[model samples]
Target: MGRKRTIKRDTVLDAAEQVVMRDGAARLTLDAVACEAGISKASVLYDYKTKQALIKAVVERRLAAHATCEQEVAASFSGDPDAAIRTRIEVASHLLTEEDRAVALGLLASLAQDADLREPIARTYGERIAQVTGHSRSPRGALLAFLAIEGLMSLEWLGLHDWAPEERARIIAEIGWLVDQVPAPVSAPASVLSSSPERSTR
Candidate 1:
């Protein structure tokens, strides 16, 4: 007897992403994914019971990959007190790609229509906000930088703006400068010398 062909869950997810990227999320269906994967619909169903489940898997997988990239960026800034905000800026500037933006837009389209699927994304953002604000020496400045970075990314993801490379670099450099302007904590002054002989040095 011939052995049955097996397909990995990631294969299905990759097919699903291609469908969303090519046809938009509205057209993503089990049969569409199966066709894209070159597998039987039953095979796709074996892994993901519903379209929502498949999309959620895609969203979670992408989030996990991004988290890994963030950790790597954070590691590069070891011993830096402002690593959280710095890493976020670096990731926004370099790590994000055109494909990432497309996937994000696709996911956003899917999540916007389904509140249930949006839960994980909302939780992830909340956690990221807390991390950026908590680890910074200047919480307000960190929050502002974070918001600005998010806005920049949002513009690209939504196809609202296509900044030239130089323009984007200048914007990011300005944001970095803003972050640098956050004042460091003031150090306590040295104690004054006492007039008494017991306290005075020879």
Candidate 2:
């Protein structure tokens, strides 16, 4: 028979996130987390089969969190596409704030060298872009908007960015305004109909 546990898997992942975020991915080890969590190595293994499994799980958790954030942004839109774009900017700005990006940065560092990780990351950003661009003009415009947002975010996450605090504030403000500037498609009826059938007939 196998031993059963009570603690949530996120607890383990959250602990793992703290370790990776604070220390860096190089120090992420099963033994270290078990020690940090006050659990045995076997217990951690029960939750995650391997290091990659753990890291992948961390990514899964982030995706799930982002999904929740997406839903929240959708709610802000209330079926209004223009408002939805603004909400998207708000979500992006919110995600870029202090400590919020830590998990993202840590996970990025963990998979920075893997080609296999590209698909999941791309898909994740793709989903976000689709949400925002469902209201955009041409398909190309939406795609470009998605790319721009992702590039800025990637720069911030990689610590490869060198913007001052005020610069970051400016960027956020500029992006918010830029996304809002994209005009929504104007929908109209296909046929030009007669103004008054009875009047015309008479």
Candidate 3:
């Protein structure tokens, strides 16, 4: 008997991603994936029972990559409360490329058809929101920085704005400044302090 060839799961996922990028998610089919992967339909199906399962796998892969990026960035600023959220903005500002923007577009298209496909992504965002808000005393400032980063990414993704590298860097730097703008500490009124219960006892 001949030995059976084993196809790597990543290979299948890569093929599927390419399919989505090229033809949109609606065009993703087992036969198309197999053709893209240069494998038999049965081979692809062996790995993913249905199209939905394969798409979910793709989403999961992206989520794993995102988590790793967050961890790596967070590690750089160990013990710094603001580092957790700030580093995420820093990393995205530096690392997001044109190819990543295209992949994001494809993911959005897929999500439009399968709203349920977003559960994992939603969970990730929820956790990230908590981490960001909890890590910074100035939660509103941190959130503003986060939103600014998202706006820049959207501009890039949409191809509506052509920002020079220097301009983009400057904008991101300004956002970091905004994030660090903690409110001035307020002192208790002198009258209230004099009338304190502890002071009354004295």
Candidate 4:
């Protein structure tokens, strides 16, 4: 019974995504979703009480999936201090798809009208920034790389820029090179270390 309910909920969400993609976010009525899913309006309401609730659910679902992907990628680079930023770069550059961008456009439309809908995004970005900078060899470099990647992704997502595959690859390669150039922290000289007040006192 639990499994059936889960499947039905996913079906509803899928139909809702399609409605947003095919029509505009403005056209995403519960009736439209039900019609698209071939389910009853009551069934849609049972899952999502309002349009705002439904949009939030859709955004949350996507964000959850992205978080899972980040975890998996971070795990693969387990011991690396730069794992968080690197994982973000890998996903933004390679993993995301055109359909994902389209869905993002739909969600952005909804988000622009509702400040409440921005909460999840704000929280996710906050967590991601903390992760990316917390143990970085060079936090500034990591942040710069992160910002650049986000800019690239935003341009693509908003249809502001259409980069050729090769061009995009070249840009990502440059970002990677920049990350690699962030020098490791230099250890203090032996004489300087020996002169430290704490060490000398000890």
CA shift at 13, candidate 1, in angstroms? 0.3
Candidate achieving the largest lDDT: 1
lDDT per residue (tens digit) for residues 127-149 in model 2: 66676667654444545555666
- Model 3: ten consecutive residues of lowest lDDT: 95-104
Candidate order by lDDT, highest to lowest? 1, 4, 3, 2
TM per candidate: 0.83, 0.72, 0.82, 0.83
Q: Please list all clashing residue pairs in model 3, or write none if there are none.
A: none
Clashes of each: 0, 0, 0, 0
lDDT score for residue 108 of model 4 = 80
Better of 2 and 3 by TM-score: 3
Q: Pairing residues by index, what is the TM-score of model 2?
A: 0.72
Positional deviation of residue 175's Cα in model 3 after best superposition, in angstroms:
1.0
Model 1 Cα lDDT, one tens digit per residue, 109-178: 7798898888888999999899878888887788888889999988887888988889999999888776
Comparing 3 and 4 on TM-score, the stronger one: 4
lDDT of 3 by residue, 1-202 (tens): 8667689999899999898878878888999999999999988988799998998899899889878887888888888888866887777677467666666677776777776788888888788778878888688788778777878877777666867888888888888877877656679999999999988966
Model 2 lDDT at residue 139: 45
The list of candidate 4 runs beyond 4 A from truth reads 1-7, 180-202
| CA RMSD (A), model 3 | 9.6
